[model samples]
Target: MEWTLWFSYILLSFVVITLVHSLLLPNLSKIRRIEGVPLVSVLVPMRNEVRNVKGMVDSVKKQTYKHIEVFFLDDESTDGTSSALELAVRGDARFKVLQGKPKPEKWIGKVFACHQLSEAAKGDYLLFLDADVRIQPEAVERALGLMQQKNISLLSGFSRFILPTWLNKLLVPLQHFFVLFHLPILLANWTKWPPATAAHGGFMFFERSAYQAIGGHAVVKENIVEDVAISKRMKAEGYRMWIANITSVASCRMYETNAEVWQGFTKNIFNGIGRSIPLAVGIILFYGVVYVGSGILALAALLVEERVLLLPYLLIILQAGIVYLNTREPLALAFLLPVASVAFILLLVSAMRKSVKGQQVEWKGRYYG
Candidate 1:
């Protein structure tokens, strides 16, 4: 086949993959409620999250699943996070505020906090909620329903991201794109292969027995990307893992500012790919040719009035449309995918440079390699 045909084949493959992948991710809205009334411990690890304290408290407070005990561990925050957490859940006896122990050597801050929360938890199901997340009242119930329906031990869902800025929309939604486009959803959910796992730290719900069986956060104690690390470990131990589509019932605004976005992504993006330089380069090149190239080709096609030359760009837009359909963004935003592609490529490159130099990445005022 000629180069154009080869390029067309690859792009078409991605479109098909995206279609199949999206279908494989379980939709929270579509699942029927489960019959089990297992107790769930809503474990939240907080560090300088004063702004999200009230929102987090209110969401879990209103959960229709009445058998939940919420645990909030303050990870030694200087910004009065402990006080705020105390005040937010003051009237609610179901919520417990625990002061986090000093993080021992070789443990990530959040991981240590989560470990403490699990030690104090007395529930059958452990739902690790991030302080920034706000879920619907039925979110917990539906999550358990999916777990029972799928017969999975660990259920992790990527929430609908609230993009407050143009840059936020451009970059954050790439998470959905990468997940739906690259990961074989069937393998990740059904297979016990460690390498096939993907997870979001913001919302991780695990069966307490399975979590303990897999060694929990201690298994991934030193891992920089603990969410993915923990999921992989669960798979390694022959446990089932499911990545769900909880966009219908939950939303999270991860980074409030562009700097936070840059830093947070920089800290995780390279490590998220196992710190492989080749994978980073291949991803940058792939987007450069498939997505960014589509824009350039479209412009040239318009100049020459060639209808055939527009096919690749149109296909790219169609692929974007399918992804945005699940993300709840406007269908028209698909046209801006090339721009998002560029932004992602640049961010990846910046992360790569920092990783290559052995620079420590910072999060919540703590530095890590």
Candidate 2:
């Protein structure tokens, strides 16, 4: 029991340190225009993104960097996505709408679209963006400047989530929390190791040469977690990849409601952990013991008049508070950390089970097996 308590404290201390380090990591500085603007192709692969296309185009039009061509690949959308793209780029010579071909065998939809977009892009730099993301006017400029300054080949930034619903508020922060707490951004940036690398799929900026050198999205064609896969690949190939908090420059409304959130996460959770059962189970157990277990033990201790057991619970709360602080989430929500942890574990398990059962994961009217 004493050994268990010590282990819990040690783990909690590590969590606290990682969270604190993440918060202290410097934010990407805003970039002012420099001479000779290079042409940047902002590649957006869309499938049933009619609702977001107009806003995305409008934001692109507002970019401070004028030397950019926008490519919207209409990935065989049955919805109004193609029409939306056509309307969004109606009079703009800088924007081009590409008709997406049928995806090749064993290729994921988005990755195939991205590969096609890359093939057609006529720019020195490629800025890959999801349709749901809205960028600030200087986002591209800042991102490019940061890449140049840091001497990085690929730069990925996590966008701020616009959480309108209760479930979104609870779950959306976990995305950033996971990256910040579990993977230290500073260490990742400094290291050449593949395990230390991470990237957000929503916003990735890459030098065209570097992107092509690593075979672009084609190398990660079938990977569901293509961003991380590509980042790891780039690192393995000795390319410099950097990730930063770009919340000030971009925001994404990833899911509108709880069901979407659940479905979306359920589809990616297993793949996110490399589809290793041991890793998945270990994560589940860790969360269960530290977050859920601590909460239950604290309550039980209160009832049974055992104050010593409450120490681990206090440590867990302290770790939760640190996570909330780093994530910039409301402190009150920290109390629900146990619930969130449990939900994450359940989602991961469900995803793994579905994978084992050969169930298809569906997204954007397409099925992936």
Q: What lDDT would each prediction earn against the true structure?
A: 0.88, 0.83
Compose the digit string of candidate 2's lDDT tens values, residues 1-369.
586578676867767776666765545556644546778999999998898988999999999888999999999999899987888799999999999999999998899999999999999999999999999998988888887777788989678778877777777778776776777666688877899877888998998898999889999988999999999998988988988878778889998888888788877888888789999889989889877887787788889887777777677666666755654556666677777777888888888999889898878787765
**Model 1 misplaced stretches (Cα beyond 4 Å):** 1-6, 31-33
Q: In model 2, which runs have C-alpha deviations exceeding 4 angstroms?
A: 1-8, 32-35, 301-331
Residues 256-341, model 1: lDDT tens digits:
99888888899999988889999999989989989999888778888988766677888888888898898676677688888988
Can you give the lDDT of residue 283 in candidate 2? Answer: 91
List of clashing residue pairs for candidate 2: none
Clashes of 2: 0
| Best of the candidates, lDDT | 1
